[model samples]
Target chain A: MTAPARTTSAAMLDEIRFDAAGLVPVIAQQHDSGEILMMAWMNRDAVAETLATGRVCYWSRSRAALWRKGETSSQVQRLIELRLDCDGDTLLALVDQTGVACHTGRRSCFFRAARDGDWQVIAAVETPPDELYGDR
Target chain B: MTAPARTTSAAMLDEIRFDAAGLVPVIAQQHDSGEILMMAWMNRDAVAETLATGRVCYWSRSRAALWRKGETSSQVQRLIELRLDCDGDTLLALVDQTGVACHTGRRSCFFRAARDGDWQVIAAVETPPDELYGDR
Candidate 1:
């Protein structure tokens, strides 16, 4: 979905409070089900790119560069809405996910639940990791 | 609600990967409505306490102390389920929130939506900050 008219990406960026690492934690939630899919980091450039391209982009700490979601797996996330928290330190991106959102191929990264003193795997992997990234 | 049978809190603790600051980011989501309320940091002690007591607790970065939710505002959050991401770096606490969860008195911290390139205040503050912490 298109961002409603008036505000510009630059103005939106000015409102966020990025951390010392120039990054803000972003949580991606399913637009329809409200299921939280994943949490990632985004830099100013990543946020601007997501807003500009309508595709979610994150700053990969490991790679130390821009990591577009599903770049390898093709499980792209289309931005439905981008939300900034009251404190401007965090973000919530309401998105339309194409497929699974976890590297493990689970629909969500939060597939493990604390139960009876231990974590129980509550959701099964929808696709195997090797399969998702095999061609790459 | 109580944590289910078998696994112990200790085992659960071992599964987590705290940051260099000895903190893990925790996202509190409304159990029934599936609405995301807020995001905060939780130290090992905070996690242990929340699992032990079933009441949400966070590590206040600013105050550098254990922050019990609603301790000041009485907007307590009762833990329904604690979830861990595959990376073991973040947490998702499914909670039954008593009242507003935002310090700004909004139901959620995410009250600002990106619209037409600008941040729009979509939700009104339910209770003024002064009123929520007036007694303190």
Candidate 2:
């Protein structure tokens, strides 16, 4: 399924309120299961890239550059839908995630739960990062 | 329900990874319905306030101070639980919302649906903003 309206990229970009660091927070969710996979930051270019390519791309603060999800680990996320919150400061990307979404090789990055005043590991790693990354 | 184990505020706070601005992105969801109500930012103090008081509080980037949800519009969100994502950059707040959670008096701030390339409003205002805010 596609968006109902085909708006100009400029107009869509204009709606977003990027922070002083020129980044916006985005949540990646499993399209089929409605499970939240991870949260990351995206710059204008990363946003443009994901919309244009249908692949989830993010702005790596540490790398100071565009980072493509699953590029290194091969756990790619195929974009099924991209949604912007009402205020446009946040985004939710529904994706068909492959393998795992966490560096720890878990199904989701939110694999821990805060309960009883402590953090508990709710889910275990589905695939080890060693296997997903395979040497570098 | 209560957590299996109890922890301290300092321990919980230390696990969080606040951004350079000392803020974290928070998503408030309806505890029973699983519907997302709104997104907000929180500083360390706001985090403590919500946990200590069981009332959701956020940081107003514009006002540069603590903002208690529903303080003005009476759309209070009582904290059901607090969760931190694995990396600790994002927070999920399951809440018992008393009224509409949007400033526009909608049940949820995410009232729009992006479909078929267009933005379609899926939900309507539960209470009109005029009545909720009342000339404020």
The alpha-carbon deviation from the true structure for residue B128 of candidate 2, after best TM-score superposition, in angstroms, is: 1.3
Query: How many angstroms is residue A47 displaced in model 1 relative to the true structure, after the best TM-score fit?
Result: 0.3
B134 Cα displacement, candidate 2 (Å): 1.4
lDDT (C-alpha, whole model) for all candidates: 0.91, 0.80
TM-score of each: 0.94, 0.86
Best TM-score goes to which candidate? 1
The stretch of ten residues in a row with the least summed lDDT in candidate 2 chain A is A1-10
Candidate 2 lDDT, tens digit per residue, A44-119? Answer: 9887777767788999988999999988989888887777777888877778998899898888777666666777
i-RMS, each model, one decimal: 2.1, 2.8
After superposition, candidate 1 runs with Cα above 4 Å error: A1-7, B1-7
For model 1, residues B1-136, the per-residue Cα lDDT tens digits are 3553224567689899999999999999999888999999999989988888889999999999999999999999988899999999999999999889999999999999988768989999899999999965
What's the true lDDT of residue A111 in model 1? 95
lDDT of 1 at B79: 87
